[model samples]
Target: MQDIENKSAPTLDQILSLEKQVWTALVEGNAQADRALLTPDFLGVYPSGFANRDDHVGQFADAPTMKEYELSDIRLRVLSADVVLLSYRADYLRPDTETWEAMLISSLWERRHDVWINSFSQDTPLDQV
Candidate 1:
C-alpha cells in the first residue's frame, strides 16, 4: 500500500522549481518577473497585513527587498488537477542587513491557461527566542 501511494503521488519538483523563481525575483528585485509569476488578483497575507499583487511588486520599486534566502521542509498538496498548495519554511536575509529571519509560508498555485501562477500566499513569522 505504501509503495502504491508513493508511486501514485504527484511529483513536486516542478512546483518547487516554480516557487524558486519567485524567490529569485525577490533576490534580484525583478518586478516584472514577480508580476509574471503571480495572478493579477493575487492575495498575500503577511505579518504586516494584507497585500495584493501590485503591493507585492511595489516592494521592488526602490531595490531588492531580499538579499538571500533558503527554503526548507517543503511540502505540496494537490487541491485539484489545476491547483496546488505549497508550504515551506524560509530563512532569509534582507537587503543591507546581516540578520537572518525565518518564516513559514503557504502559497497556492493555480493553473491558468495551462500556466501555473501563484494566486494566494500567507507568511507567518517564526517566534523569536
Candidate 2:
C-alpha cells in the first residue's frame, strides 16, 4: 500500500503560484478577488476575536489594526483531496500604534469544484526586533 499523505501532494510550483494569488489579492485589498476565492460561510478568528467573510474582506476598512500586507516563506501541506493547509509570515503595519509588525499566519484552504478558497485563517503577530 502507498502512503496516504503523499499520494497527491501539491508540487511546490503549483503551491507557490496559487498561494501567490491569495497573497497578492490580500495586499491589494481586492474584495472582488476575495469574494471569488473566499467562501461565503468563511470565518476567521484572529488572536483578538472573530470575523466573518465580510470582516476578512474588509480588514483595512473596518479595523484600524492592519495597514499593510506582506507575505513570505509560505509552506503548504496537503491535508486531503479537498483541503490544504499553509503556514507563512506576514507584515502588518499597525496604524493604531504606528508600528511595523511581523506575524506567523496559518490558513485553511478548501478546493471547491475547480478553485481553491480560503475558508479560515489565524495570525499571531511576531515580537518586534
Candidate 3:
C-alpha cells in the first residue's frame, strides 16, 4: 500500500488500469484479488438493487466466469484528494450468453490507509438502439 497523498494522486490512466484489473479478476473468478480491490464496506448498485462487499465477492463462489468484455469511454473525476469517480461503458458476454450486453458503470474509489479501494459502484444497463 503506497500513500497516494504522500506521493501524487494516481493519474487517470493508472485508475483506469486498476479498474480493468478488477474486471479481469471478476472474469477469472479471482475472489481474493477482487476482495483486495474493494473496501470491506463496499456497496454495489445494480439492476438487482444493492449488494454489499460479501454479496459481490460471493458471486465468484461457484466457478464464476465471463466470456468476454470490452471497456470504452472511461472517464475519471476527482471527488477529493482521496476519492476518485470512474465511469465507463462496458460491453460483455456472460458465461451462458451468446449475445453481448452493454452497460454504463460508475465506481468510486477511496484511498484508505495508503491503499485505494473501491467504495461504491453502480451499473445501468444500456438499451440497444
Candidate 4:
C-alpha cells in the first residue's frame, strides 16, 4: 500500500525509531503495540524456531518478555526504494533476571501505506563460551 509509485527509502533514524518501538513493546508487555509494529505475515527466526507475528506477540500473554534492552553497533541498508534491512547487537535482560543476554539481530522492514512494518527478523544468540 505504500505509494510505490513515489517510493522513497527511510532514513537510518526513522528505521531505528521503528525498531525501538518494537523493543519498547517487548519491555512493556504491550501486545497491541507489538502487533501493530509487525506485518500480518511477519516472520521471525530465533534460536528456538520460526515464529509468526502472533507467536511473537504471544509471549506477552503472561507478562513482559524483556525487562530492558539496548541496541548498539546499528547498521542499516536500503534494499530497495521501499525496503530496508537493519542489523544490530542487542543486550537485554529478561523479566526477573539480573543477568544480561546478547544477540545479533537482522530485521527486514518494508514500507506500506506510508508506514514501516517489520516483515522479518532473525536473532543469533551470543555464544557464552
Best by lDDT: 4
TM-score of every model? 0.91, 0.72, 0.91, 0.94
Candidate 3 lDDT over 1-129, as tens digits, reads 966457566689888888988889888999998888999989999999999999888889987567689999989998887889999999999988899999999999888986888999999999987
lDDT of each: 0.91, 0.72, 0.89, 0.95
Candidate 2 or 3, higher lDDT? Answer: 3
**Per-residue alpha-carbon lDDT of candidate 2 for residues 50-127, written as tens digits (9 for 90 to 100):** 888887777646433345667788788888876888888987675456566788988788777556777888878788
Please say which candidate is ahead in TM-score: 3 or 4. Answer: 4
Q: Write the per-residue lDDT of candidate 4 for residues 44-87, one digit (tens) a residue.
A: 99999999999999999999999999999999999897899999
Report how far off residue 28 is in candidate 3 (Å): 0.6
lDDT of 2 at 80: 83
How close is each model in CA RMSD to the real structure?
5.3, 4.6, 2.6, 2.0
Q: Residue 79 CA error for candidate 4 (Å)?
A: 0.5
Clashes of each: 0, 0, 0, 1
